[model samples]
Target chain A: MINEGCRLMVVDDELIVCKRLKQILEKAGYDVTVFNNGEDAVKKLELESYDIIVTDLKMEGVDGMKILETAKRKNPDTRVIMITGFAETETAREAFRKGVFDFISKPVEIDTIKQVIIKAQKEISGSKT
Target chain B: MRLRIWHKMIIGMAIPSFIALLGVLLSYGYIDDVQKRHGYEQIADNINDHVLEVRQNENYFFHFKNGRFLDKLHKAILDLKNSVNKISSYTVEEIGKEDFALLQDAIRTYPPLINDLYDNYLEETNVTEKVRAEGRKLESFVAEKNRTSELTSSFILHLRLLEKNYMLFRNEKSFNALNSKLTEMKKLTPHCFECNPYIEAIHNLFETYKKSDALVAEIQLTGDRLEEITRRMAQRERQRIGSFLTKTKLLLAAALVLLSTLGPLFVYKTATYIVAPIIRLAEITKKISEGNMTLRAPLREHDETYFLATSFNTMLDKLQLTYNSLERSIELLNEKQAQLVDSEKRASIGLLVAGVAHELNNPLYNISLTVDAMKDELNELTEEKISEYIEDISSQSKRAHDIIDNLLDFARARKSTEMEKQNIVRIVKESFNLVANQMRINNIKLEQDLPDEPLFIKGNHSKLEQILVSILTNAIQAMKGNGTLRVSLRPDPESNRIVLKISDNGQGIPEEEIRNIFEPFFTTKPVGQGTGLGLSVCRSLVREHNGEIEVESKLGEGTTVTLKFPQYKENA
Candidate 1:
């Protein structure tokens, strides 16, 4: 049961996309926060610890790729799922190599995110144990 | 005649040698005739000298009355006779008819006339003895009778005077005076028995004297005629020699002229016939060896030169054939080398494209995830339009992912494993949908004429879609995003094929580059805008479906691409 209190963060350039993702993740019983841009997301990353980070791959400044890097540096155990309107194999590979939790594309499916969130919760608990 | 070179040479040398031999022979004959004429003249002069010697001996005998002179004259005459006989025999071959006749007459008349003069002198001696006997008888009778007879003594005196005149004078007048005195002495004789004896003796002496004088005059005339004939024979001999010399001169002149002119001419002609063709063939051989394969020896005569020229030309023909085949092989080798270089270049570009294509996948996946999330949230919305908007976004993201997959497939040059019998019209419509938005935004007019019946083809669905989309994208771009584009699909029953044509009214390819359009990496597009492999990849995909693609274009006018695929059969 992934309804146990888990802290999550979502980053994207599109406010609607970020808001929608945040809503879906909250309904799935995870404490989730959303950012419309990577600049605020990187500030959040320095102050707090998150169990999972979901960020868009492309952005205006301090892009989701940089946020992914900052999240992994602050806490190696943090799991990240990168989202983007346009997907690239190289950027996805780069995100994974930097210790991202997973990668997903836009027009995202709820079932797919649910599966990913469930998997991330198990991984975090497994690491604690 | 078809004379060979050797035959001509032989004749050329033979002619002059023959002429020279003939000239030599003719000169020999001319010299021989001159020698014979000289011999005849010497013989004739010797005969004249011998006759003159016989005449001088005869004159010595007549004037001296010596037996030794007569003997010498007879020997000289016999010697003259022997010379005349020798000359007559010599003239029998060399002299002409009239001269031979004169020599024969002179020989016959001279000996008989000289013998008749000797016979006349013997007759005169007998007549003198008879006359002297008669006179002695009369003188004895007159002394015994003691008769002082004046007539008898005067007759004896006349008889003695006539005998002296006959011996001293050769003229007719002196001989007539002697005869008249003898006649007067005869008339004075008495007609008695004693006078009859004296008259008979006187008549006998007168008859004998007249016969001897006539024979001597005939001999002298025959000797003069013999001398005249001998002189005429010598003159005829000189005339004959002169004519022979003139004839020989003409003959020698003709031989000289022929040797000088015709000999050289014949030699030159033969040399030209034999050697000129050989020289020409040598020149042509040199030209051919120097790489002028087109040259050949000129053939004119049907001689040895003709055979040589024909053979040379045959060799040239074979050489030209070999050279042409060698050239063709070199050209083919060069073409294969170029193809190898082109394929190597394509392989490198393919690797670069693969790298780029792999990087694109993540972005597409991100877009799909976002759309899926949005669609799931919108499921609770009551507004029908909001649900439709969410569905549209979802489908568009799926299309974008599909495009990236297609790019990866293209970069690796991979053919899809799954193929199906699909409607070609549906494929075209789906492909057109992908580019239709861009065309609309750019003000490009799109026209399509598809048959009502579904035309099916055997091909992978995604690959077929890729082919149509690639062609449509090119057409749209070529039209500068604002021009008429026509697309048509129809069954070409004649060929049992389905034909698809995509045409645009835009800047078309140049004529020179049209043939290179199918080569990988060949393109007219600016850098970064095209990978230059669009048409080449399109053609390869079409070929994989057992289809053919062809492009036609005119610069500044338009471009049309026609794709044909064999119709799928039920049994097949």
Candidate 2:
């Protein structure tokens, strides 16, 4: 079971994709915060702690990779997942090596993402216990 | 006309005048010779009569002296002496002589005999009276005889002197007269000897007068006869020459007439033949200068002028051919200009359509994503009452996405990229995937007769795929939602080309409009539902790979579009 109050950040330059992801995650009983750019997401993350961060790989200023590096250094317990429309394998491999938790291809089915979020919550709770 | 007449008249008059002059000259020569000969004959007769008288005088003087009538004899001898002297003086003056012997004999004997007769008359006075009477009678007879002898002697002496003077005068006069006659004859015939014979005869007479008066008279008669014969011959020659001159003049007149009259006629005919044709050729050349190339003149003679006509005709033929070729080229240029204008209009329209489609795509994509999220949210609602709403939203969102995707695909103006070897079959399959649902919606039975083997072509993959999709979509749409569509792909063995054919069993395009279907903005569909650029774009794409597209359609039957792409040969 996942805590409904755990905060998660969703960042994407496209307003529609960002809004959709926030709505879906809110329906699934999690507190979600949405930002239209990587810079805004990074500013919010510096002010408060988020349990998990899901971000678009391509964004204006302060990309997902840079946010991941800064968030991990500021708070080592925070988990980050990279999301992109382009499914380039080399970039996925590089993200994995850089300590990103997971990579997701866009036009992603809602059920698959829900399963991935549940599994990631279990792992976070187990680590805390 | 007057000049010609003048020429003829002058020729005629000159010829007659020349003949008459020649005749007159010949007659004048004959008359002069005859007159000279007659004068010579008269002089000769006079000399002969004088010689006979001198002979009679000598005979009478000798007879009276023999009869012893001394006084009567003296008177007779004096008379005879006077006659001899007259003859001698005539001979000496009329005829040139070294000596007049007849006159000398009469002078020497008669003067001595007359003196002797006078002495005898004084001594014989007392002789017998009877005898004296008889002697007186005899003396009277003797006196008559002696007077005749003296008269004869004086006549002979006068005749000798006259003959000498006459001979000298005749010699000088005849020489001068013969020279004058010879000069006149020379004008006619150059040589005349009628007076020459007379001169020679006179010289012979003078020589003979020294020997005997009778011999002188004989020589003069011979000379006179020769002169008469020469005169007759000269007259005959002059008459013959006059006739010959008249004949020559007539012949010359005839020759003049022939030359003058015939010369102009020959000249006129020659000028007509030569100069007339040349003038006509010059007129034809003027016509040609005025651009009347059809003008031609007849060639009369095979000469340089005729050769010029042939060359001119050949040049005209070349000029006409060149002008005709120029006209044809101008016509071709006009046709090319018309085609260029038509192409430019189509290109402008294509650019406008592409711009409108591009503008609509991005916003339509955002709306589709928002609808998808709403559908998902509806599905997760716990109330079964909203299940229908969820299904409706999902289906509508899918439809909206499909419409936007189709619009985007149509609007995308993709420039052809670099060529690479690509599997043509894979491209075709991808194009089919894009149009499969439309095929289902149309209930069109789609059949693809594509080769299983990987067929490779050198072209841009995206452009080839677009070409396939456009043609297939057209075929399916032509079925009008319920017909059969067949796409056939095959390799042309002879040309090493790949051929693609799409056919539909629905209503066909009109035969008249089939040719225009590949033209941009030419469409049979309702406005806004169809952009006519589909077939046109397909054609352009195929052509980019050096390919060609063609359509065959018949009214109420079917339509088929065939695309042929040349196979890429590495060596080529």
Candidate 3:
């Protein structure tokens, strides 16, 4: 209920992964956009602000790290979470250090993703008040 | 009986030696007989010579009318008789009784002739002595009467003159004159009785001498006949000795020839029987040494060679047995080696299985999360949202199923049903997914530099995926939780080949052991941690696709493996 009006973005090379994640988050009363590639998500990040950004670690052309960097640069207020098939790299740790909000490994649970977005929305509204 | 070599040798020598000995014995016997016969011949010859000498002596005694000649003749006849007896004794022993009869006849005739001659000689001596005594007595009477009566004395003187002329001449004229003178003397003797007695005595001596001479002639004739018989016996005995010698010589020669010819042949036969087997054994041994174990020595019966052949065949059998055992052992060794390779293959598949399991965990966990969320929020969800959630759930489950099927295919080693043109980059990406979770979990970094353009190759996609997965899994494991894994693909236009290289900055292999890294069961990982067949299986998989795999490594720095495949071209 606290995650209603949550602006969220999901990116993965597998369209199914992105779609499944988006559907689960949108059903939980959050605003969700799905991208099958990091490139489209990065292009959308340049024009819009979101409360949370979820992206896959590996993709064709652009990757999760690039999306994280673009989100942090365009809007310092945006919370970033990385979804990866790879869970055992310094990349996830480095993303965390660089102010990413959270890291999840695929195929991620919708509940966990929803919980993290809800938490991010509370932090944003709490900071605005 | 089984004949030993030494027995055969001894018999071989003994037979020839016996034959030679027999020849010698036969020669000795014949020669001895010849010697004895020769002795008999000598005796007979002596007897014949003595008869001739006796005859000559008789003639001389008659011709000379000397006492010395008569005495010599008597001694000669006695010697002749003794020699004849000696010949008879010798012939009796040497020649058989049938042959001895002639000698006996000679013996019997000789003694009688000799006795007759002796009797004749005694009579001649008696007559001569009587004539001389009577003449002397008449001489005394004539002397006595010459003084008393001149007629008596003159008649005695005339008789004496006639006797002296007859003794000196002894011819026919002398004989006639002596007869006339004797007649005149006989007429005158009527006048003188003393002179008549003397003249009558001389006439009596002449008659006795003629009878003695006839007996001598008969004795000579008997002696000649005896000599003829002895000569014939000697000649016949010599012929018999000659024939016996010839027979004995022929028998000896035949024996020698038989020994010389047959004895050596028998010895040679025995030698061949003994030695041929040994030679055959040697030949078999040579062949065995030359690696032909199938040959065997032939068995023989009842000889030393048979025993040798038996031993040889037994040894060959043992050798063959050992050889068969060795071959069986080698076959077992090959089977064990094959097992090792197969187990190593299973081990590598096991590694892939773990990777696949880990890979499936993500999608399965996603499915669980999505379904759980839908269950929790089902009452509030719209129809479109429910359909979307159900679709997502179904697709994620399908992903998990696909991973399992790939593993099943790899585990079964089933050939991919479909062969098609594939892009190398897509295959590499798919293989990486299986180990991507493991790689990330271990803090290993993977960097890929695949070509932008599709690198085409004709192969089964799943098998190619298996090859790449094996290589990546090895690289990840070698890094042991921390290193860089770089996969790069490029085309070589010059060779019309495509090269895929994987480099890892991990605990690189040592220089000496790097060459063995691709051999099954060769492991740098601790026991139970790695099967060590990853790289070997990778090479095999690559080769199945007409590719070559090579690795270059430096100790403590890094390892790079290059895989090359013939480029698939649309047109030649």
Candidate 4:
């Protein structure tokens, strides 16, 4: 699959997270939209859907689980990757059950999430074929 | 009714006192009777004395036949009458009034008899004088007649001798001879007129003597009767006095015997009443102090001892309760001591590990990513972009370093229990950092109501952090997925302590279980989920800081755990 213009959404309450993750994934030629908070991400998910959603699992309000829930419900093919500093097993299991593509713990390794997103892009392309 | 010791003592003493009083009253009555008898005896004695005086005066009147003696006898009779009159009705009842009346009758007759005797005596004296005159005339006549004739004179002389014999002897033979001689004299001197006069005088004197004898006999009889009455009265009064003294002595003796018997009886009874229960209570006290807390005082009479027993029982109950609670406290202390060690390690690792992992991993991941990104773009990246990446790397590394440093300090809390004056605001904030991620992940909303100024409190910083972290962990867990948690700090003006409140709008504790929330091993969480030592450890640590922890909750509302930490004093 060519990494030409795969649509991606990044949601994290940390500005550093959104900033760094957006910089990394956009440099990899993925069309990425970033939100520093989950509320805005959820608001955006209402109007638009992405092929892949990268979100931090914990936020002040409308956290990663809500984003995951919204993204998957809007489009089943949309691959949602969960990132969090708190890697609680139960939350991870719940995210998996909600069909999150992958769960990563913070401070996120840019390559790992990039690889997961690249894989999501391939799957998107493959599912389209 | 509860009789106090003093009341019982008064009652115990009063019984004997009353008996003694009764005895005294009874003795007083007997003594009064004796005294009445004594008064009667004195009156009888007075009457007897008066009768003696009358008898003495009457005897003197009989012997001397004088008007003075007669007057004395009359006065004595009056005195006797007066003394007899002085006898009271009450005295008459004690000593029979029959004797007294007899005495009065005797006195009345005796005085008159004595006066009659005196009058007879005077008449006898006049008759004697007349006889002397007549005798002298006869003697002169006889002398003249007899001088003329010798034979006649001899006969007259013989008759005169016979008269002398009659006067001297006063016998029957003498009196007959005198009579015959008188006849002869009268026949011989039939012509003598003086002899007739002498004979008449002799007859008058004899008549007066006979009347005097009769009156004397009557007077003697009456006087003897008065003396008898008086003597009888005196003897009877003496007897009565003796009997009264004997009776009074008997009454006192009886009272003494009764008092001696009953006084000791009452004393023993009262002593037993008071001492027996007290001894029992003392024994119970000894036993209880010896650790037989089960022992209780027995209820006895409804007196002071009874009240003592009841209060003693109540005290025993309270002591037993305190003893049981103390035993339970010791048990809890032992278990809590064990929990303290386990939870200190468990909780620090439990709360801190997740916290350290998240906080540390966030910066660590950022630094790694930025470094990896810089490494991956080393060939194609612009110097401007590279410098920007380098700056991000440096900042992210510092963030990572700070998370590790905070974690190191948290871990150091367990080893160093040294307390220092620390700002509670900083403690609250740093401790919250450990659980802030957890709260966020659980979608718990926080409302901070903290003072802007630093709230200084003397405490072990790490321990304070552990307290806050564990409590926050509990609040976050209770909220489960979503809830509002309010953390507030204020300097309580009243207690001069820093008050930290952590309240959650989560599943509030049940009312019944709330009391046990701080109890070690008491947990509402399912088995194996919670070691149940969290709040208990928090409570002890709060206590160590000389602070208090209180939980207020309503079922289905929320739980607010308020902690008070002693404010740090600069001089302290």
**Chain A of candidate 4: what's the TM-score?**
0.94
How accurately is candidate 4 docked according to DockQ? 0.38
Which tens-of-lDDT digit does each residue in B1-572 have in candidate 3?
88887887787678778887888888888888888878777766776687778778877876765667777877877787566555454456664555346545654665555455566666666766776677677777877767655446556566566666655564557657766866776665567676655556666655655565566667666666766766776787788788988988898889879888987887788677667767877887898889988888777655777888888889889989999999999999767754654565576577777667657866776677667667867788989878877887888889889888766655675445365788887788777766765685566788889887788887777668767777787788778766889988999899999999999998888999988988876888788788767677677667768889999998778889899988887753
Largest DockQ belongs to which candidate? 4
Comparing 1 and 3 by lDDT, which wins? 3
Q: For candidate 4, write residues B141-235 as lDDT tens digits.
A: 66766664522655656755775675456466876786777776776657666667777876675676667767878877877887787678778
After superposition, which runs of candidate 1 have C-alpha atoms over 4 Å from their true positions? A1-129, B1-3, B52-75, B87-91, B111-239, B276-324, B334-572
Better of 2 and 4 by TM-score: 4
C-alpha TM-score for every candidate: 0.39, 0.29, 0.52, 0.50
Better of 2 and 3 by TM-score: 3
DockQ of each: 0.09, 0.07, 0.26, 0.38
Model 3 DockQ vs. reference = 0.26
- CAPRI grade, predicted model 3: acceptable
Ranking by lDDT: 4, 3, 1, 2
The local distance difference test score of each candidate is 0.70, 0.60, 0.74, 0.79
Ranked by TM-score, the better of candidates 1 and 3 is 3
